[model samples]
Target: MAILVAFGTIDGAGLARSEDTSVDALQLHGPLARLLRPLVRLFIRTGMTFPALSQLLRELYINVAEYDFALPDKAQTDSRVSLLTGIHRKEVSRLRGAGAPVNVVPAALSRTSRIIAYWLAAPDYTDTTGAPLPLPRAGEAPSFEALVSTLTKDVRARAVLDEWLDRKLVSLDEEGRIRLEEKAFVPQNGSEQQLYYFGRNLHDHIAAAVENVLGQAPAFFERAVHYDDLSGPLAAKLETRSRDLAMNVLQEANREAHSACETDAGGDWRWIFGIYVYREQMKPADKDIGKDAS
Candidate 1:
């Protein structure tokens, strides 16, 4: 997620006031560029031209300004949206009718994720040490069929198992028990499921950061530890250690959340707790720049 530095307060209409608008825009430039660099690389790799992205961004700007920044009790007009977003009024009117993008999580993806969560968190599916237990293919409450049944009765357990096996998420052992892979929760690389999660996770993370920067009360928990100039071996070691610690935290949170939701009166609210670990080797130029700065 990009680190945002707020230069001004948002008005009731959710816009930076005119007086500080330029300053806020200038302050935002660097972080926005940094954040988009990786995304731009992805766009290029996926053969998305600049013009296509530009049009998408234009629509998104109009959409956000129209719906999110509308003045209270006042009908949002194309003129106002264009003014706020700096798009032409005609374009704003044209695209506003196009509607905001819908983010629909695939039914299979949603069900699969929840099933994995249960396997990792539900008392019936986990061992005494809180680790997920290998389960027999069918029959009985702690079996694979039972685990899937808790989430959905519409889909057959055999079908889910077949898909999981195809995706390398689970495997059958010599004892005929189904075992979740070490990274079972992670969707297969380059698959649509992975792309869905890629967007969702990043969106939630960046949204939290944006809210905090906007000076929301009781800031969302956002913190990180960073160190430069570590040896290759040390970085690897730290990555492994961080993975272990992060997984423990995630699993415990999942268990607590699952238990709470079991008795939760349904609500419109949603929550996500995510963790990421990254390690990149410093380039020679970057090292030189660091040394010069020091």
Candidate 2:
């Protein structure tokens, strides 16, 4: 991505905003390059070459340049846009003539996401304290089957249950009750789910990070804690504790947000709050590698 950005921009120097800082330059930009390595490998496996990505990126870069760069008196010229985006003047004209991006999410995936949303928000599916209630598999109006029907009549309740069970988001008890095991319903496998996640999760996360760097006044929640070294046993304990603490906070916040949405009568604002836990082991250092080879 960095290399593509460099090649596409003026003299191989990519576009930078005036507000960019030294910390932002190193911390954000450097990690982004490393992050794309695995994604690039996936693209290769899927037959999406660098050229294809570059073509799509060209259009994206043009869109950003058109919006982010201020227009002087009169219309934004192809020459000026070319200078800003680092694309050639003729190519800028051609790209500018092209249509805007189309957003067409699959109906099934969208309905599935809505089901998860309603499951979290609706009072029928939750207890007095706003915790999700373990529901009977079938029978009455408030049962799990009824909940599935409210979202979509096309899909059966058992099908939805099977998908959730496959993802480990929900579990079925021996007595035929359905219990929510995860705060959010995420598909563990399938291309449709992966694409949905790529759109939803990555877009929101990147947007929040950008807002924190660029926006002023009330900030969005963005924070993390990291340590380089820890014993394996200690790290395992910390992971468990972190998951517990994060889930409790998130579930409480979810209840409050749902209540606010229900009561607020005259606004069109929407927001998402997400919690994620990640841990990975560091590669052995060169010094340590030599000792082990002896």
Candidate 3:
């Protein structure tokens, strides 16, 4: 008989079906939270860093299942994924062995196929072309424990590439699956274009917000405003300054710490002083109807 497991995800909860035995659920948590964690770690290994991963986890964690990547027609199967990702099937297994997040102990593997199955299948069944495949044609469905066993192998690969990624890029689903994601890779056409994307998105976003607040006047902002500074004489002066004076202070502050950056509504990014309004829109003038009448 097929076993079902539940896992918690940052985006939402999911369910996976596996060939392994079913287990009990957590109270402060649910069955889903217990299932889908391991995949989060994989994402970290792939190249995202911890802070980025945490940012993604905090804002949006997807409750993925086995079918999302394991289904035959709709999703990429394990063997196929092993090939595509350039990691061995055995290696994936070892990586997973490092630990899954669901169990209270965080030592061995957990049976999370039902929850994982849903995670794998959801995007394929709903968003993509993959279908609701009942089972594999070539082999028996992997036991939930076996699936965990298989995935643990990727740890070696993770070791090789850990420095390139941030810790946040790796995440744990409730079922113990690992997952990873970073900004989509953009093919670099020229010099550091791709490298700039990460910083740029944030810089532009903050710049636009400052502009809106300033209306027509050129706006300026500062970065790395230390808490201690906020309590000092500079803070009092900033609070009392006129708009232009404040903008200058912001610009000067940014110059002092130009390396610091910020993001705004549009997602564009710039350093505190790196952002500047080059042009200003003039205010509308009053109507002159007396000259128009014939």
Model 2, position 142, has a per-residue lDDT of 72
TM, every model: 0.88, 0.70, 0.15
Model 2 misplacement above 4 A: 1-31, 35-38, 44-47, 68-75, 97-104, 128-131, 137-141, 149-175, 180-184, 266-268, 284-294
Q: Which candidate is the best by lDDT?
A: 1
lDDT of predicted model 1: 0.80
Tens-place lDDT per residue, model 2, 101-167, is 4356788677777776677667788888666788898887678899898879888999988877886
What lDDT tens digits, residue by residue, belong to model 1 across residues 178-265? 9999757666678878988898888887887677666655667665655668889988998999999999999999999999999999
- Sorting all predicted structures by TM-score, with the top scorer first, yields 1, 2, 3
Candidate 1: list runs displaced more than 4 Å.
1-23, 99-102, 284-294
The weakest ten consecutive residues by lDDT in model 1 span 4-13
Taking the tens digit of each residue's C-alpha lDDT, what string does model 3 give over 1-294?
Answer: 112122211111222222232332343243234223444565576777779665444222121222234555674444654554455566544342232232142221112222233323333222233322222112223322233234455434334124213434234356543343222122234324333443454445444433433342332322221112133454555444544564456434533342232232444542323322211222232112212211
**What TM-score does prediction 1 earn?**
0.88
